[model samples]
Target: MPQVFEFKLPDLGEGLTEAEIVRWLVEVGDVVAIDQPVVEVETAKAMVEVPCPYGGVVTARFGEEGTELPVGAPLLTVAVGSEGALGPVGLVDSGSGSGSGSGAEAGSVVSAVGSGAGSGGAGSGSGSGEAEASGNVLVGYGTGAPVARRRRVRPEAMAVPAAAHVTAAAAVSAAVPDAVQGPVAVVSPLVRKLARQHDLDLRQLAGSGPDGLILRADVESAIRALTEGAAAATPTSASVPESVSAVQPSRPSVAQPAASSAVERIPLRGVRGAVADKLARSRREIPDATCWVDADATELMAARSAMNSAGGPAAGPKVSVLALLARICTAALARFPELNSTVDLEAREIVRLPEVHLGFAAQTERGLVVPVVRDAQARNAESIGAEIARLTEAARTGRLTPAELTGGTFTLNNYGVFGVDGSTPIINHPEAAMLGVGRIVPKPWVHEGELAVRQVVQLSLTFDHRVCDGGTAGGFLRYVADCVEQPAVLLRTL
Candidate 1:
């Protein structure tokens, strides 16, 4: 018996009601296992890859890739055994056992079939079993819908607007697809990413998605051709460093001038849009102040260097400077609980957190993603380092879930990697404070009237002044400096 399961879109946070399918990793007839990523979903903030929850053969994708699907809407259909047939993208109230998108059609409201458990019927529309016919699958199963194949009729290159012309309002007001079988396929995120990478005009590339949707593969194929042509013309003897490779003279400049007429309004709908809102809210709602201090990290550096050099069989993951800092900050927060609190405007009170959930700021292609390292105070330095490594990779690949990105009480942004001396980083919304670590540079310091070169890093602390006073913020910075100055102290704190 061929049993089928339906996978729907999961609730991505921050009041996000829906997401646009960005790409499809699997296709109909493709066999997949539980937790295998099948679709990529582009939320208002980032592109997230959804994994499979139930292992089986793919039957139908309810919503076409590049189509905007409501949260809890069916995205994919999988056949576990020979029990039932999965329906189409758009729903049909028809009882003919053939839902070929010819009934009361709406976007993502596809009719499903199953045994008369009432669990399997036509157009249940509710996001529930047969595996929540139109809701997000578990984290292991990926998010978003399958991208449909589109065929171009004419070169409608000049029909669509430029990237600069698109806005959130425009996106919202854009024509909705009236197809009975899912919304008309639009440009996939993969296509957009590829287009940006190759400097290709998205409007010019005809969509290969269902109902003429443009997919990433389409853009990639075009980019590959363009690159191959360029490579054939150039000689292999000419090489340039990747860091400086972006400085080509022939590249067209996309500089936006400062005049009202000169500036083209780009809509804040996705990652950039979300970032703007969060930053603005943080600035307006939370009163913030920054304090800076320099710490001598010579011993810490020596310890780390020595550990790396004497690498025998280690018990756990290696400790990193970031991990050490996080552990220290978590401990310090225990002393000044005010520093680990968030303002609840709705509740009209300050919520002091009992445990420290550290949000490590990670830079991604889709702006900054802060994945939380929960219960940082309880985790050892080695465990914290491992979590950071895992989350960083997940963020980059758009595999992070809403839970992993939320519920952090504080944040840590690393500027040392960029060789920055110090900076006042914005507070991640709801968090009371953020700690910035500057580059560890050797400089002469006055010790007992004698100048000595020491490895020093500047610690910049930005805090929500509304929650904690300068005295408390200063104390937290001092405590962090002391821990970094004496790396051994962290072990005791942990």
Candidate 2:
């Protein structure tokens, strides 16, 4: 009998529960050596290629590309020893028929990767466990048994009341059975509650869940009829509209006031998800403030265009306004060390980094991705421009790695891309500040004490007040403006 061993996903890092399988380097019937990179897993942090723990023929693969698999779940079953370590096929659900084995049969004897030698046989139903539901991940090989634990609840509880009406409308349209006994159809939890509280008939309300269904608003409107008479009697003009007092033309009655709720439901995922987490942490952890300034960069623009025209040694990736702005911001960070830091929320402390890796936002079809320019402190204008070009291309091509996305000490968002003047852009969380760049437009400006049309831009600096004050933020922007106004000045500073 061939000795069979199961490989389970290990915790990649900090509280990660699952990872998307990118590719498998090895295939079934292929001989593999120990510690060989057999598979690649893409986590939120980065893409990690995992090494094989044992030398054996690939017996079976249990996951597919882009499928998020829970850590501690078996990845593949490898047979040990000489005579082909093939065991019964381990099935995995990949939706398409392309995935391997039907997984372990219920009551079939199987050992999980982290489970010890003395594990009880696999007891299966619909495979409901922490391995399937949790987002915590396991990344590497370990000999110990899996930790037994219960579900982890969120620190803050989510309230349903605020969205009850919306859900009720969806449910009512879906035709889910409800206890509404009237002409109006029952919709959602909130709608049901509203109707019962106001003594409105639910059967009469139409649903709006999936179809043109009734919702909480339908129920709320029914209750409104009773109270509206009393509200109209009040003397406040805001309470009673002018039309209500005027002689109105009689029109055909509209269909029993179909539910008309105006609210947008956006899924909290991807960029939106990251934005929410960062904003919440920033609010809970950092004190932030803002500073603004107007900069005349005619000389800067002239120099940049001249360099690009000559295609000189300094020439690189069509010198963009954002690239110039990034150079200025990075140069200023050297002058103000405190701005390039993060706060330890637990310890209530600030951390100043030694170098700058400016996070430049690149908007893509998927979402906004920020690929950092590592060691921005050491690079010059040309190098910065080239690196920015490369990183931006990679981001747009969807080829960015997780490492490229992390460790940014400061961030720069160019709203100017969409032709906006200036606005307070949210600080990419944990980073003490984020600089928002506005459009470069021709405006009247004083040059050598004479008024002239010059390329002018607005810079908005939004910083964490907990880590920096208004003065610091203002000084930083002033320094940037100085550098851009006289590009040669950077040579002295560098």
Candidate 3:
């Protein structure tokens, strides 16, 4: 007999707690190799393919596609052993051979119990089979060498009475009367949370899953029933006697109800939810302020075009406008380090960071995300441009990892792509400030003591007021604007 190893969902890291199953790569009874991608799941940050460490035949799968499961929930089980050692076992309903039908069916339940007993005896005899531990230290399992299996307790040795099984089955048809009478079989924390929110006793509800495991659907149904019952029990005004009525209008006028058909409700979840939560927290905790300035970008645009035109094959990637702005922001932060730090409110201290981990905002079909470029202060415009391009592509493809989406000391938001002139950007939480760049368009400006058509852009800086005063914020914005007006101003720092 093969030893069955249960593989739970691994931590996708970056403080993510749950993910929605997007697709399954393996099915029940399929052979899988070690470290092979088993399933694709969409977390709050990105879409990730989770790999299984054990190489074996898939014995069971827990959740269906599109189902949201918390981290550490069992993803699947694999039976590992020598080739042809473990024959195909029906896995739809746990060692029970309950057939692919309703668990409430009497014939299926009886067959499942009988088959479980027989399998238990077989499992006991083959307990000496060798089983190796996959050396991968993931969310649940740890690394170790292969070890000989211990004999499993036979089902016959600790079997529940057949009458008890019948009683549990009968409980499925009728509501459980007492909450403390028996154990409630529930697996998902989300299910428990829902039950707790509604003050519904799980013990008083029979589960529809294998071994009477309470599923989310079961709890939802119980809540629905309770709601309908309460609504029905409420007395209506029409039932009151005319004699007991306080006062009645001779002619009652009915007001027309407002139309709700035009309203659309989109669930705030996944990337959108994460963004929403962070923004709300930033607003709640950080004392933020925004300042804007218009600058002549004629020199900056010309410099970029000239550099790209002069570059040969070995000259490397062309610098982007956003990269130039990012580079300038880094220089500005270096001169005014106060704007590059976060406030440790609990400690009642302001942290002035050293290195700049610059994040840039990118909008994807899923939602808006800020992908961080590590050590942006050390990178030149060319290097920063390349990284931004790579992260943007990954964002577009939904292939960015959680680590790539977090830990930014400062953020550069280029909202110009939306054709906006300026925006009061919200500070990316924990970080002190964000620089927003608007579209660079030709405008009539006074240059060199004369009015001329110059490429101009609006720059906005939103900083945590707790960390810096208006003077510091104003100075930082002025330096950035100066760089835009005269690209040569960056030469001194370079």
Clashes found in each candidate (C-alpha, N, C closer than 3 A): 35, 41, 0
lDDT per model vs. reference: 0.63, 0.59, 0.69
Which residue pairs show collisions in model 3?
none
Candidate 2 local lDDT, 290-325, one digit each (tens): 788888888888888887787567545676667777
**Between candidates 1 and 2, which one is better according to TM-score?**
1
Error of 3 at 420 (Å): 0.8
Compared with the true structure, what per-residue lDDT tens digits does model 1 show for residues 1-494?
Answer: 23456677877676888787676776544557677787888886567778778666654565544456888977776655322332221112111112332212322222222211121224233322543343211111111233232211121211212221232113212222222223224433545544555555444455656766767666666655545435455434145332222222113545434333443345565666777889999888877899999999888888776655665575445678888778778888887899888988888888898989999888887777889999998887778889999999988877777778878999999989888899998899989999999999999986558899989999999998888789988988898898888878766655
Number of the top candidate by TM-score? 3
- lDDT of model 2 at position 105: 22
**Per-model TM-score on C-alpha atoms:** 0.63, 0.61, 0.70
Ranking by TM-score: 3, 1, 2
Give Cα distance to truth, residue 413, candidate 3, Å: 0.5
Error of 2 at 432 (Å): 1.1
Estimate, for each residue in 389-461, the C-alpha lDDT of model 3 and write its tens digit: 9999999888999999999999999999999999998889989999999999999999999999999899999
